[model samples]
Target: MRLFLTFCAFFALVAVVFAWEKEDHEIFDLVSSIQASEGKDVNFYSWLEVSPSATTAEIAKAPFVQAYRKKSMQLHPDKNPHDKKIHERFARLGVVSTILRNKESRERYDFFYRNGVPVWRGTGYYYSRFRPGLGTAIVFLIIVTSGFQYAAQHVNSRRDLARIEDIVRQARQVAWGPRMVPVEGQRKVKVNLGGGPESEAPERWISMVVDANNVYFLHPDGDMELLDASTATQPAISSTWFIALVRSSYQSAFGRSNDLKEAEGVSPPQADDDELSGTASEAPGSGTVTPREGQTTSTSTGKRKKATKRR
Candidate 1:
């Protein structure tokens, strides 16, 4: 019975050691994961750079003085209500803040940081001198299992974010119509006109010739005018009243006579140029002199008279 009890005690001791080893391994793994995520080696000089003149009191007060205070308050156990993760995070934050604040503990931390060494570096001296094969096998198993789990979670998170962004982009495309118009067989032209004091011509002229699909223009005082295709001459008529008459005539001929003013709405087919010109046609004479289609003629009895067409 004595031997059996001793064996049982030994077994219990072995089980406790196994559990402790497992816990330590998990801690090392977590530290490695954090280092990888942070993207840089933990340097000894970094803390000093953050606060070179750090006193014990200053270090202790630093976390609360910084932005982490608001985070801690929000993540505190009581504030978070029933949130287990927030409570765990809050506890971890407190632990980190405490370790970072203590001078002696911080010095040891700085040693590891400067050496680029992990806490498990002296495992051979601290832990039992176990067989190399067994130690390596145990570590390998833990690493493979944990690494697979981490990779799976990381990949899933990236895919989820990508899908969310794609959905948002599609919704935006629907909300705001097509963002671009394809350009094909398109041409652009720019015109420059000389208008300064040194220019020879003081007046500017700008002409858009539809036949040439070209625009010709000058600068400063010149005016731009559009002429009727049929009636306009090269040195175009400059009179405002004649231009208005041409526009009225065009509108009348094109069945857009409704656009004409009452004063200018005479039916062109029924009225001759003499009737259309009205006051302009009359001159101080014996009866009335009216200009014919091709030649100038006199109207004594208001009768039609043929005239030779000018070559």
Candidate 2:
């Protein structure tokens, strides 16, 4: 029984030691994670050292202004174009001056510097006070990452919008239908219907016609039609260059029409091959089509379909 008691005591001691070690390791890990999150060392007092407690008016006085102007001019790309480091220094100086010149920004900056250590409560509140450095680091990382993500998204959005606009502009430029052909040795041009039925207008038509100058359309009856300011005109049978004239006239008229403005307001709908395939297999006049897997439909149908993931 004694031997068993001694053995039990030994195990109790070992268990206490293990618990203590585990707590210590956990604390250490928490500190390390916080430190890793904070970025490189930033001089906390650099702003205060550069801008002192002087009033904005005092800081902007003749001597300070002259010194800043001289330094900025020297660091300007036009002056030190070859020195990248100097350019960065110049930009930093400008930022410093701007902040110092603002009374509120300068006062807040000074408040943090005079305090023993500013406790940032924004993002690292979970870190223990004993690990203040880690907390500060966490906050810094959060701010930097958020700022970078925001800037990247903004830039990407602008690039995408510009690209979309360019594509739409190109599509508009080439929207006219097939070209018209002029009769040989005749001044007039004859538009070939190309076996299409008469009475059917071109697939596309200009609704708001303006002064004829920029665009023309081919009619089903083998004739090129042109819009004009005073009246619409068809080229005489002797006009061998009818197609070119029709195109120019249509361009001039449509270029200034309200159609372009309307087009600008309309956004292009998204197209997916799967949705299109499904629409093709849908029953006619069903009003709604559900596409099965591995299928899509064309754009001609009255119902527009988008690919939806099956549950």
Highest TM-score against the true fold, candidate:
1
lDDT of 2 at 180: 28
lDDT of 1 at 247: 80
TM-score of 1: 0.25
> How far out, in Å, is residue 224 in model 2?
99
- Candidate achieving the largest lDDT: 2
Kindly list the per-residue Cα lDDT of model 1 for residues 88-176, writing each as its tens digit: 56665555455557776665555444454443433532354444577887776766765665566556656655644443333333333
Going through the candidates in the order shown, the clash numbers are 3, 25
Over 1-311, each residue of candidate 2 has an lDDT whose tens digit, in order, gives 99999999989766654442333333333333323432333322232233464577988788677767876676677887787566555655566576567777656545544552223332233344346587887777766765665566556656656644433333233342234222222132223322345646653322221122233333566454442222322223223234346778888898868678988889999878856765645578767756575555547766655555678
Alpha-carbon TM-score of each model against the true structure? 0.25, 0.23
